[model samples]
Target: MRMTALSAVLALSVTAAAQSQPAAQALLDQGKWQEAASAGAALNTSAGLTLAAEATTAGASLVPDNQKKALFQKAQDYASAAIAKDRSNADAYFELARAQGRLAQFVGVFQSLGLAKDVKANLDKALELNPKMAGGYVALGLWNATLDSGGLKGAIAVQATGASRSNVAPNFEKAISLEPNTPIHRIEYANALLLQGKKAEAAAQLDKAVAMPAVTFWEKRDLEQAKATLAKLR
Candidate 1:
């Protein structure tokens, strides 16, 4: 009787946790970053940790500059925790890479150089774990394009860090193929094209991105940026 009772309790707990996941994910999808993070914090699952990491990283942009690093650090910690729980959790690795990349933005160039390796490694691992992960491809594309734009500095950095510049277009193309409806992918690819002085090609991408419907807050922000860039190009 005691064993049966315990089993029932466990089943109920599992059901409740499973139900919370959708609610947390809904918060994330809606860009309720703080609420999503808080919801994720209440759970003790890999999904919860990954959601927390994503929410924290997304929320960092809304915080004061000085608070951004700490938020990203928290995001990194949550992602690491999720990885600790499940090594095959590709989303966790992606979130870690995203957090690290965001943190790099606030640091000096030398500090950013050091973090570039880590960001690439995590992104690579995420892709290795989940080859179909379109977001990972986008991140990798951005990495390649950013390094390629640095010219001599980029060349030295690539030589020193083993970051690839040759895969920029292919990576972005792959991401776009995987998630054709995602506006950010096109926007990012447009940015990369602009870096290479392909203004006409970039404008075409921006036009597509600007026309896409943005459901999430981040997507809306990307769409706005795309519009701004397109206006300038025109």
Candidate 2:
């Protein structure tokens, strides 16, 4: 009887430990890498995988290949672990999408196309699990836009697919309406306006995003970049 009680306690403890790793991963998904690192510090391989996946997602947006490559490796490690833990875990798909996206950024445009497809597959699975996950939709849309696979045609494919400048503007607008405080959504809408050849309208949205009381410092930086781009257009 005592052995049975001890075994039950051990099982509960292991479950709790495993659960926290995924929780850390959730924080990472929302661009909270530091928080995720803190949450996952004492965990095992699965937890480390969560941390690595978050790191990869954060790294892919960078302009440097070295940085992107490192992050992709980290994300790959965690995503593999996650898949090992639960083959059907939808969140693992999101991590894999992030990893592939980072790796694609490091590779050339042609390679990026394949990575974009992987991102779509994982993101599609994620949405299947939770249709209301705004981030997943945004990520998928961004991936599709980047590859010019969704409404992308020719010379302007990069802008059309990634910025979803004209094609997915309404989606970002809808996402913003759903969550007013998220500055990234507004920025996406601003980009869409620019893609639609509405420079002035895009600038206005950027200004509004920059002025938002809830805007983060990073978001403000993105707004400034948008302003610079718009200035060149004007």
Which candidate's TM-score is highest? 1
The Cα local distance difference test for each model comes to 0.89, 0.64
TM-score of candidate 1 on Cα atoms, chains taken together: 0.93
The best candidate in terms of lDDT: 1
lDDT by residue (175-209, candidate 2, tens digit) is 66667776666676666555455678777777766
Q: lDDT tens digits, residues 35-61, model 1?
A: 999899779788899999999999988
Candidate 1 CA-lDDT value: 0.89
